[model samples]
Target chain A: MIDAIVLRDAREHWRMLLSWAITAAALISLQLSVYPTVRESSAGLQQFIEQYPEVFKKVFRIEDYTSAPGYLGTELFSLMLPLVFIAVGAAWGSGFTAEEEEQGTADLLFALPVSRVRVMLAKGAAAFLSLTAVGIVCLGTLAVGTGWVDMSIGWRRLAAGTAVCVALGALFCALGALLGAATGRKGAALGISVGLALALFVLYSLAPLVNTFDAALPYNPFQWTLGSDPLTTAFTPGSVLKPVGVAILALAGAIAVFQRRDLRQL
Target chain B: MTTAPKVTPLRALPPAEPVLEVRGLSKWYGRTHALDALSLTVQPGEVVGFVGPNGAGKSTTLRILMGLVSPSGGTADILGQSALNGSPNVRSAVGYLPGSPALYPRPTSRECLRFLQRVRGIDCRARVAELSARLEVDLEKHIHDLSRGNKQKIALIAALMHSPRLLLLDEPTSGLDPLVQREVERVLREAAADGVGILLSSHVLSEVEALADRVVMLHQGRTVLSAAMADITGRLVQRLTFEFADTAAESWFEGVRGVAAVEAHARHVEVTVNGSQAAALDAAAKHGVIAVHSHEQRLEDVFTELIPERAA
Candidate 1:
């Protein structure tokens, strides 16, 4: 019964998930197509990267820009891939959870014997799975693309970076679900979650240049995702743990509000 | 147009136990009170009509019983459990059809029914087929393409497939044609005969009078009247008009028993009857009446008579 909600959502939105996976693979192939040029002029590019502000290099996780892990991390996972994952997660999270209320179907859904908490969790799970699918597809593309470009970004490193992206996306998914349930308005939920994600991303990007934000970076979700250079370094337990804990908190808050609120739309 | 007996003769009856009970149930949306200390009860095997005008707290009461909305203050019990936060099991025993029920447009009626059936942990393919056939529902059609009546049939099927112990229907026949309305009524009657308690809410007094064993009336969020259908028909004052063959005169029917007032003009005489109109009709016969007309007592008329200050 619980799976029924999740399954129906997946069936309804499989096309969205498939399109995102194709886009992620396309981006990876498009980026790797240029890796050979970077490798040919490694020393010159290394110097060019060093001339960037020390803060910018650190923010990009670019100690060795000529290497496959370094090149891919700076190009994709640093900004592009994380944004993709976050968008996918947020889209599914907000749209799926709030649609029943927005479309005036909550009267039918909530009238069932199922509890609201279960419905909330089911939607969160479906969104998380969509993000996970995109992450895996992105990882597969990166694995093959690095080899075709004559580089060795280790498989474990690729997995680590993708894991971080997925975890970050999951956190955003829970946040989107929370907003959707709290407001019962899909547009508002998606707008606020995306707005908040973009704001936090900007802060994370600029934090290295601003010493004042140094203390907060340790707790920031975006920081947890890429701050340690997961593609070049090992993925630590804390990397996934922090975002997961916050996701749980967000989901708990969502369930608490959703269970008690009156279905105003109906 | 219903011609059901105004008062049915008494027959041996089964013992009764109320499946729904409410006391002082009040709901306030901010400062606007929707239900004002309303009280009601529906016993097993009884079809109790919850009749009122639009915005008369009928929908609010039903929503509270379904636990879709909570009351500001009061107690409501459905099937022996508190209706405020009734559990899944409590709801499982009760089937509910919301007024203007919301359904997913993407799924065919069959798909929608399967999903709901799976949620209830039951396989209802046969019942689905049967109910769809009985209601003339197009199971293969997508809900978005279905007409309003067809969509309503889908919702009705969902409400009845589980064979629940109690049925809480809000304006169940609002959009139905006469033919389909009669079919739904027949289905409800059959369910009631199986000892199911039914609370049917509608603004149409005639519909309730024809089907309900008892009727409760609401006005401005408060219960203004509650009684058996027979008692309601008997207690209500009605008007009758008699057309004369010759000159219309107030004198011929004067002082007739049960005739409260008479106004005459042209070839017709209008009489207000307090109880039996037999005496007045007898007088009209002697006066060579050519035609007779009974002014039906609509639900709105009842509201005007019972709560003139507020209803006006």
Candidate 2:
């Protein structure tokens, strides 16, 4: 029954699927745009590395960016994942609770034999499925492009990055659902979800730039996304544990808030 | 075709068992109490009209029953289970039409019905067809494209299609045209005949006056009056109008015991009384009666008189 509801929502919201397809295509174009720059600057990059290896390495994950897998994952997962995750989450979340009241269809939904928790869970499942499908499509396209360019694909790193991004997408989707349930307004949910996502991203990014912040900043969800090489000898347990923890916490909060809330006024 | 399922389990229950029971139910939004110690019973085959003014807790009661709203302090039972404790058992057996029937804008009428049918887990295609035919709802248009009256028809279809054992309607006839209203009333009668319990809340008095067996009036989140239609109407005031020959005749009929209100016009004197026609005639004879006409009090009159006015 829950699967039916989720699948039905996906079928109904095929437009979002199309939009993600277009976005993925655009992202693929952007990734390839940087290929010529990397190829042409290799000599200069090598010279810089000789003079200041540590500085160059700190500025960019140079070894990872040289490969097609890293290049795509760098731009897409590191940059595009947050954007796509939030966009999809907001799109799905905008309709979740508020639409019931906004369209006055809540009375119809609540009058069904389904529980409120089931309703929220079903919608969250739909969002997760859609976001995961988009993530897979994006990663799959990048893998195929890497093969086309004759570059060795980092299957391990790609899988890890994609997994983390998928989780983050699911986390944001839950956040959107939570916001929707709390406000009972679509615009409010979108505003709060996107605003929080941006604020977290800024804190995670700029926190490392500050000299005093290195020890205090590793737990931020933003800090985990900065690294391009997802699978490596240097990949610490903290990188995997922190973002995953935040994602789990976010999802749990959304479900808890949604379960007890009254679904009236529609 | 041979049918093996002779008696559906739901149908085996006795008629005396209420499909819905609400007791001492109260809900407060912050400091403002929305429903206060409200209690009511709706048995099978009863059409109870829940009447009240704006902000009178009629909608709140229905919402609580539908499990859309939770009560602060009380209990409600639906089909033997606590209504607020679990996913409302009442929902499957109950069909609810809200005061404002807002539907999905993107889906066409056919698509909307299919969605609702899926949610309800019932194959309601034939039922939908039957109701649309009776209610004269056009199915090709999208919900947003339809007028307010037409949107109401789609909602009505969704609510009625399941052939639910109980119906909860809030202002069900606000936007409906008169012909559609008649059809809805007829459908309600048929549903009642089939042993369905219905609780209807509306400001439209004539629908209640015409269809309800019993009327329950609420005021400020509490039930103020509840009685059978027969009894209420019998107790209701009837206006008696008789034209007098001259002005001197008014003094002779000034303080008759049965007359509750009397208004003396230039040509005719109108008197409102609660009892026998013989007594009304006896009072009218003193005024030298020329013509006599009487109109029984409508539900509107009873409602207007019974509900105290809000203080300025």
Candidate 3:
């Protein structure tokens, strides 16, 4: 049985976790329901899409509006799903440390006999578990929506895409955790996590338009998550491995920083 | 000097191994000194009162002992284990109540206690129930809805539930009502009787005087006084007020060997005596003293006398 901080964190966040999972499910279902209509209007939609600037279409991952995966990728995975996960991840990560310190609860927490590393690891595990739950919910909802829409999307592809989403979410969650550990301030953690995610998104989007940025695409976190188009491509180990590796590194960094720094109560 | 009150432990016990020890413990935040080369020890079953004004490193020392903050130099030990690198076994034997405890808002007091019980890996339900009843805390009430005193009671219950060997309490009676304060004091006494070592920090001098076997007074991040309760009491100055037939000059009492301070009004004078009062009384009697009233020195007065700059 998980003890102490992990169990306490999970209990505290039960409602927020449920809400995030439900929101993910709702957003995925709502977008997938519109897929058939988008396919029906593809000819008209393609003409409208052509009028969109090349950079905008590329930024939004607008390609083959008739295909199930392509349409879902553009409408749901490209922005909406990532945004939801980022928000959830950032909120959980920041709350794990920074918010506790801000509210003066860290004093009570650190007073326990457990080591700081153990506490940090427990909180990290809780955040990862929450993001994983949201990802699983999203995959289940996506499968249900596909069945309802009479779409022939493979379960394997959806699983692969969801895996990519989880990895991406974990990456940003780790970013938030790192900032939370470093700053011991919730506002700074949230701001830096969201700001970094947005900056990476913008950088990845502009890579094709600008040669200078295109050269940096391989190293970009946004590219690692969606650049391979997980819905269409076969599962490539590197695609998932890179983000997972980085997420692990970030979490490790968070643990190290938290262990060394004083547990400040705001 | 007028005789200071003879202070003694409310309950006497044989000396035992130190349950809490700090040797040359120092902490610095950049250029500001939080704790200087401070050292102290708490023996088993002893209550050591940690006294200091605001920003006087009392909290810093407690934080260091709890392993919530790293020290710049020196070592702190609890039960012979390094406190700076605390372990579950070590922490499980220790109970701490922060100066300003903030429990999770979402949980009811019952739920919060349950969580702490699980975290501490102790079956403390009976103890929790007993403590909650004693402290008059409503366990069913959500912590967010409770008043500060009620919340403090919940924290006190949590800290005491496990019956740990050592209790590091920071302002334990703060924000509590007099009734609750008395209850807490009783609990501390009971815990000490159980051979639990306690290091308590508070702004309340009377609380310290009542409970501490030894009083360690800190000023500006350093220990100014560390003595047995009796010694601290013996150092306290007596305050004497005299109403004289004729107005007396302040210098008359000042000339007395034991008089520490003298204030003269129109027909009345107040004298603070450090040792024997005979010389001061004789001086007042020579001025046609009509009536003389003497007051035992309070702990607060002693604290101010020790830390004069703070008084100023």
Question: Which candidate number maximizes lDDT?
Answer: 3
lDDT of 2 by residue, B1-312 (tens): 110112223434565788878889999999998889988888888889999889989988888888777789999887666778645445677798888878878879998888777766668799898999999988988888999889888988888898988899887877999999999999999998998888989888899988898899988888888899889988888988887677534554566777777778787877888776667688777657878898888888888787876610
TM-score of chain B of 3: 0.85
TM-score of 1: 0.92
Candidate chain B TM-scores, in order: 0.87, 0.89, 0.85
Per-residue lDDT of model 1, residues B1-312, tens digit only:
111112222222345657888999999988998899988888888999987767889888888888788889999877777778746656766788989887888889899888887776667689889888888888999989998888888999999998877899988887888888989999999999998889999866677877899888887788889888877777677899999878888988789999889999899899999878899999999988989999957555766677665544
Off by over 4 Å in 1: A53-61, B1-15, B286-291, B298-300, B303-312
Per-prediction DockQ, in order? Answer: 0.45, 0.40, 0.41
Off by over 4 Å in 2: A33-37, A45-65, A223-228, A231-249, A264-266, B1-12, B244-267, B282-288, B309-312
Model 1 lDDT at residue A83 = 86
Question: CAPRI verdict on model 1?
Answer: acceptable
Summarize candidate 3's per-residue lDDT along A102-178 as a digit string, tens digits.
89988887777566677777888888887888888988888888999977789888988887778888888888889
Question: Highest DockQ, which number?
Answer: 1
Which parts of model 3 are misplaced by more than 4 Å? A47-56, B1-15, B240-292, B309-312
Clashing pairs in 3: B1-B274, B1-B275, B1-B276, B2-B275
